[model samples]
Target chain A: DAGVTQSPTHLIKTRGQQVTLRCSPKSGHDTVSWYQQALGQGPQFIFQYYEEEERQRGNFPDRFSGHQFPNYSSELNVNALLLGDSALYLCASSFGLAGVVYTDTQYFGPGTRLTVL
Target chain B: AQRVTQPEKLLSVFKGAPVELKCNYSYSGSPELFWYVQYSRQRLQLLLRHISRESIKGFTADLNKGETSFHLKKPFAQEEDSAMYYCALSPSGTYKYIFGTGTRLKVLA
Candidate 1:
């Protein structure tokens, strides 16, 4: 099923510019979650989407937002990016609704490496 | 606040030696813990979860609620086992996961 897939394996952007990263969930999965992993750090939860709405959000700033389409594909949008935004953006997919039995086990993609110059 | 911590930034062990990756968490309610592994040039994948009580690639972790630690261990490490390992926690009734900074395991030949 190719599992979870993300677009643009790597990206380069300047400060104050905007960028959008895309993700397609695994087959039959209905939820998508976004995470940011800085170099030498683990992945930090950004937000989660289910049923086309944001079900949960992390402590990230308002500049980081996301959307989920009907097919469960998701997009992570960052506005006015800062140099600190340079990191590996990861997209994870899981089955069932949030807090469900199987939702906590997520499958991750290759991740999009975003570099803010 | 919910958080996960992996104290060691890097761990080196000889092939066939025992290995342990330490992880501690801070959370109020029942926590679902998971160990994730990322091999070189590969995506991050789930190694094991506390609920399932199963081992993957001969690695197992026991969630000690008393000490609030879920440490991953393997009796005989192999060269293929070298990778970055992360400990994660999902608070009760939530899907968001708090991950540790991760430990890089290097199994020398």
Candidate 2:
């Protein structure tokens, strides 16, 4: 089955520029979460979206926001990006509580690498 | 504050050697723990979860609530096992996962 999919695979933007990354939830999954992975570190939770509404968010600033669509696709937007924002953006999907999610397992897509100049 | 910690940044071992990657977590409530791995050019994937109590790819982890640690162990390392491993925790009453600083494993031939 086609797993979670994210695009574009790589992006480059200058400081203060805004960027949006997209992700398609795995087939039959509803919840989508975003994470930021810096060089040599594990992925850090950014936020999670369920039923088109943001359900939980991490310690990131207001500049980091996300949206989920009826189709279960998600978009991560970063405003006023800083050079430190350069990192791999990973998107994960999971079946909601009503579905048979395999206990807390999150399927991740090949992340999109964002490079801020 | 709840958190996960992996003390090792990198670990290298020869093939057929026993391997262990340590993970420790701090949480007020009972937590669910997991190990995820990412190979070169591959997407991150689940290796094993403490709740399963099942070994995956010859690897197993036991959750020690008393010690507050979950260490991944494999009897014999394989070159294919080389990858980045992360320890994650799910706080009680929430789905948000707290990940530790990952430990990269290099199974040398």
Candidate 3:
């Protein structure tokens, strides 16, 4: 019954360095989405992965990439990070059903706090 | 462009008083709206969605397509209801959701 779980609850990285945050979707969930939440701001969608392929992406740049494993786990990787990248990275999972339905409800993880020093 | 807006950054109300959090959205096509709440030390979770047309924890929001607004309202505010509320909208052709800046609700006793 465990919900979405993320690894390395907190991470510290220097500017220009790369970092990878991991997430395991809730049990029985398939679709995984990544979001970035700056301090005092709501989350912004980065991208979404389904069946190991990115189905949709937000307005983020190519420096931000993600991979979804067959196990439904996901990893968010950011390259040449900037101070602006220092924010809480949230991972959400859902059934990826079409339109609005109970299955479309996205369950979110506690989130990984990334600090770019 | 799809966008969600929560005009109020902070809302304070005395406990037991009525509370309302306003939300407005801009979208060209059919959109699905949702209200997500994050309590202190808690994960961000879905409070309710327009499609469900259901209320949760005594909070209800009505989606007015004509006005492009979905405002969350509660009859009596409780300290436990204090949290960060985000308004999100999903466009008709995409699964991506756009969220507002969020409103922080504070209920004082």
Candidate 4:
């Protein structure tokens, strides 16, 4: 398996513009999660999707949203981007079981480098 | 609020020297802790998880619930071990993870 794959290795946008990043989960994986990593900082969880529904969310604002398709692929959408939003957007996939913490081992992709001007 | 902290931004050690990357967390309840590593030009990957109690690439971490720390350590560091290390915390029954700012380990020759 290719593990996890993300599209558009890099992106550039201006303030108030929107952006969408895509991710394909590892083979047989059913859960996908999104994270944002600012330069020199660790990744921060944005949210997670399972069964095509958002299962959990982090402390991010409403402008950051996501979707999971039936094929287990996922997309992260950032609306009205700001300079602060420029960062590496990461997508992780895992086999999820409700209320099961051990199955939450996530495999991450190369991540998309988003630069907002 | 759940949070993970890796106090040191960078750590340098000579090859074959001992290495330790400090990680601390703040949370209530039983949490699952993990260490993640990112090599240059590579994706971030899991190094080890507390629940598994296993070591990866000569690194091991013991979760100290009392002190709320999960420090990664290796007796003999190698040049290949140099990378960015991150400590993460996942609350029980939650999919979200809280990650530390990360420590950049540089093993000099």
Candidate 5:
């Protein structure tokens, strides 16, 4: 079975430009979350989408936004990208509504490498 | 606010040596701790969770409430065990996870 999939394995953008990264969650999954991992650091949660609505968000600024489509696929958009925006954009998916299982594991994708110049 | 911390950015040990990766967390309420690992060229994946209290791939982690730590340990490290390990936390009844900076493990032959 296919796991979470992300589009445009890599992306390039410049300051003041906007970029959108796509993700297709694993089959039978309903929740999708986006994370940003800078070099030599762990991923920091960007936000989470469930039921076509954003459920929770991290400490990111308004420039970072996301949408969850009816098919459970999602997209992360970064506006006015800065050089620090260059990092690995990771997408993870889990199976449930407000999934609270202690064993709940988020399956991740290969991630899209975003480079901001 | 919930946060996770991995003090060591890099750790190297000889093959067959014991391995211990430190992780500490800060949360007021009950928290779910997890260890996630990413091997070379592989996507990040879950190694184990504190709730399971199960050993995976000969690795285990115990959540110490008093110390607010969930450290990953292995009795004997193998070359394949070398990877980037992250400690993540989710507050009780929440789905969002806060990950630590991560510890890169290298097992020398």
Candidate 6:
């Protein structure tokens, strides 16, 4: 079975430009989450989407946003991207509340490397 | 603020040696801890979660509430075990994960 997949394996943009990244979850998964991983660091959660609504969010700024589709696919949008935005964006999928009582264990994708000039 | 910390940036050991990757967390509420590993040219995958109490790839992690630490351990390290290991935490009933600065393990031959 295919695991989580992300589009635009690599992208480049200038500061102040907006960018969007896409992700398709694994088969049978219902929830999708976005994270940013700087070089030599672990991922930092941006937000989580379930039932096409944002359930939770991390400490990211307003420039970061996301959307989940009825099909469980997701899009992460960043506005006014800065130089520090150059990092790997990872998308993770899980079965949501149906699979686990607390929180579902997440499976990640290969990630899209975003570079802001 | 809740956070996860992995003190070591890189750890190297001979094959067959015992391996331990230290992780510590700070959270106000009950948290679910997890270990995620990323091998070369691969996506990050779950190694073990504290709730499962199951060993994967001969590795195990026991969550210590008092110490607020969950350390990954293995009796015999294999060369294939070398990878970037991240310690993550899920705050009470939440899906957002707080990940620590990862440790890169190198099991030398």
Q: Can you write out model 4's per-residue Cα lDDT over B15-106, one digit (the tens) per residue?
A: 99999999999998999999999999999999999999998988999999999999999999999999999999999877789999999999
lDDT for each residue of candidate 1 in B45-97, tens digit (9 for 90 to 100): 99999999998999999999999999999999999999999999988877789
lDDT winner between 1 and 5, please give it.
1
Best by DockQ: 4
Error of 3 at B18 (Å): 1.1
TM-score of the A chain in candidate 3?
0.94
- What is the TM-score (0 to 1) of candidate 1? 0.96
- Every candidate's DockQ is 0.77, 0.61, 0.63, 0.80, 0.67, 0.79
Point out the worst 10-residue segment of candidate 3 chain B by lDDT: B89-98
Measure candidate 1: CA RMSD. Answer: 1.3
Give lDDT: candidate 4, residue A112. 96
Expressed as tens digits, the lDDT of each residue in A1-117 for candidate 2 is: 789999999999999999999999999999999999999888999998888988878989999999999999999999999999999999999988743323457999999999999
At residue B5, candidate 2 shows an lDDT of 96
Each model's fraction of native contacts: 0.83, 0.60, 0.70, 0.85, 0.70, 0.85
lDDT of each: 0.93, 0.93, 0.94, 0.94, 0.92, 0.93
TM-score of chain A of 6: 0.95
- For model 4, the docking class works out as medium
Instruction: Report the lDDT tens digits of candidate 6 across residue range B1-109.
Output: 9999999999999999999999999997889999999999888999999989999999999999999999999999999999999999988877789999999999999
Write down the TM-score of every candidate: 0.96, 0.96, 0.96, 0.97, 0.96, 0.97
Candidate 1 residue-wise lDDT, A1-117, digit = tens:
999999999999999999999999999889999999999899999999999989889999999999999999999999999999999999999887444644457889999999999
| Location of the lowest summed lDDT over 10 successive residues in candidate 1 chain A | A96-105
Clash totals in order: 0, 0, 0, 0, 0, 0
Q: Over the stretch A66-104, how does candidate 4's per-residue lDDT look in tens digits?
A: 999999999999999999999999999999886565546
lDDT of model 4 at residue A104? Answer: 65
Q: For candidate 1, list the clashing residue pairs, or say none.
A: none
Mark the regions of model 3 whose C-alpha exceeds 4 Å error after superposition. Answer: A97-103
